[model samples]
Target: MARYWDDHTVYSQPSAEELRRKAKESASTAKKKGKNYSPIMPKSRRGEICTSWWGQAWCRNLESYADYSSRLDRGKGYVRSGTVIDLQIHDGKVLAKVQGRRRSPYNVEIRIGRLSEENCQKIIDKCSTRIESLEKLVSGEFPEELKEVFTSEGGLFPTVREISFGCSCPDWALMCKHVAAVMYGIGVRFDENPFYFFSLRGIDVDRFIGVALENRVEKMLQNAECKSDRIIDEDISSLFGVI
Candidate 1:
């Protein structure tokens, strides 16, 4: 007898419990093999993942791009479920290992264009004029005023055109679940260290602050000189009885 399977029948999807079990099994196996894994866990009991403003801003930047909105939900789920086994950031790119339905993990790479020297200098100049902005950065806060500097055209944050990504998963979508999880993981990383965001853009925070301090000092000296000149002119006019 020849048995034929119906091609039109829909396959049953794995339940949430089954997916979690599979993820845990794979993670345990990888750990036993001495594989280093860096998983993102929700900080709050209510499942709050990103607490810092910088982190939230990073996520918001991704969401603002309508093209990525569709996959963000699934990515968030993967990140929360400990599917992103490891994520590393380098000079101009991020590398990650994401666990999926397959026994083996998927590789993901996210590339962001580095800021040019001219653009870096421009950012330094902008931040230098605002002492509060530097203070906020030091305190791990993102200044509302500096938002324009980063989100503006040709700014620190990568634009849609400047950012590109790839995943080893079989999914053909431009951004697969693995890629999205890694992206969200970056936001969590930013929460832990806001400087990571600047690093991603290849900007040196210390250098930026140093240049801004110099600018501040120069402006102060010029203002003092002008004030002294005005005082001397007033004195001379008073002595000569001139208006």
Candidate 2:
């Protein structure tokens, strides 16, 4: 794994092989011919936004992305917090990744202390009915103490603001524990319904696709219109001998 430095603290640790290679490179530079050569190995740069210790731990705990995703048979939830879903490279455009939990106190931790997916599934498999019942209770299907969490003044609804995101927790971070917990819970829900992930993030995948198509169409139309206008202007100027 690659590492990033932030505020005098190393967020991720390099893999064993990378560390070994770096050591060898440094040694080679030190044994040069005549001129003195600095023995420091150059660092190879990678992409921004990396998986933190917490995030990677969650994945390892969950078995793997494929297995975890398989549990979500399209009804419960999904991981929709980050802007980038997976690392994809395209032709010329390099879109900055929008997701991946960086190890920083400044951000919310959605899956910090959760059990690995494989282990959690074992528990659920052992007690499916009980787990389902708990889900319904917390969801407020019937009146109970859990209703407070989803009520307007209680939990589900929150105050909106233009300047600030309007989080009430005292963490002084971009997102509070509440936000992190919500995100983490959504990941668990994803084990039931993967489509629920986008819904939780307030994103309509279909609408996003439509918007992208419209943007491309508009760009093409603008290019065509400009070309036609230029041709017409040149023809008129030629006819009037004003070129």
Candidate 3:
């Protein structure tokens, strides 16, 4: 039941509920056709699109560098209305189904280039001494110095060239409203789980944390037997895997 359109097709947008119904029908059709049709709906229809430093930074990155800023207004409304019926994040790619005026949700795929080894190493080296814990990192509570490293040019954030997207909405513009909604939805996901950004960039969080802690850990272990050192709680030790 998905709809396809050419340049000549003009659409009178449908009600949000109608669009949602269409998306459900399409998912049903896909399931009948033996395709995976699981859809991830937005957690809320009436909250900020993004919150926290990392999430805001993601939205800003897309607006500041990408030409999609103009169409972002259209998408903000869609995303806030819960028109983004599904979104899936993966290493180097984001897949989504954005409900539109068409007969079904439009398919959206965004390709994000993996952060290069050199850039990743640079961030690790710059932040190794400053980051206090993995929890802080994932919660966007890291120090300002670390934030600078992440948002800096050629740093953790992606540039325009490192991103490419396509949507099945058939709009001739450079980026359609459906694509914009998905982009905002991506930011919302970051607010929910910041690690999604790392996964989207193909970065391993455990490896990054371990490498960053290597020198400090070695020093701590070396000094332990030479002098008296207080032991941490069992749960804390187990949580950090230091036991």
Q: Which residue runs of candidate 2 sit more than 4 Å off their true CA positions?
A: 1-197, 228-243
Worst 10 residues of 3 by lDDT: 1-10
Report the lDDT tens digits of candidate 2 across residue range 99-189.
Answer: 2222111222231122233433332232232334344433523223322322222122112221122223243445433343333333333
Report the Cα lDDT for residue 141, model 3: 53
The predicted structure with the larger TM-score, 2 or 3, is: 3
Mark the 10 consecutive residues where model 1 has the least summed lDDT. Answer: 6-15
If the candidates were sorted by their lDDT against the true structure, best first, what order would they fall in? 1, 3, 2
Return the TM-score for each candidate structure. Answer: 0.79, 0.20, 0.74
- Give candidate 3's TM-score: 0.74
Tell me each candidate's RMSD, in Å, in order: 5.1, 24.0, 9.7
For model 3, how does the per-residue alpha-carbon lDDT over 151-172 read when each residue is reduced to its tens digit? 8976767887888999997687
lDDT of each: 0.77, 0.31, 0.75
Candidate 2: residue 223 Cα off by (Å)? 2.0
Which pairs clash (backbone N, Cα, C closer than 3 Å) in model 3? none
**Candidate 3 error regions (>4 Å):** 1-9, 24-47, 131-135, 138-145, 218-243
Better of 1 and 3 by TM-score: 1
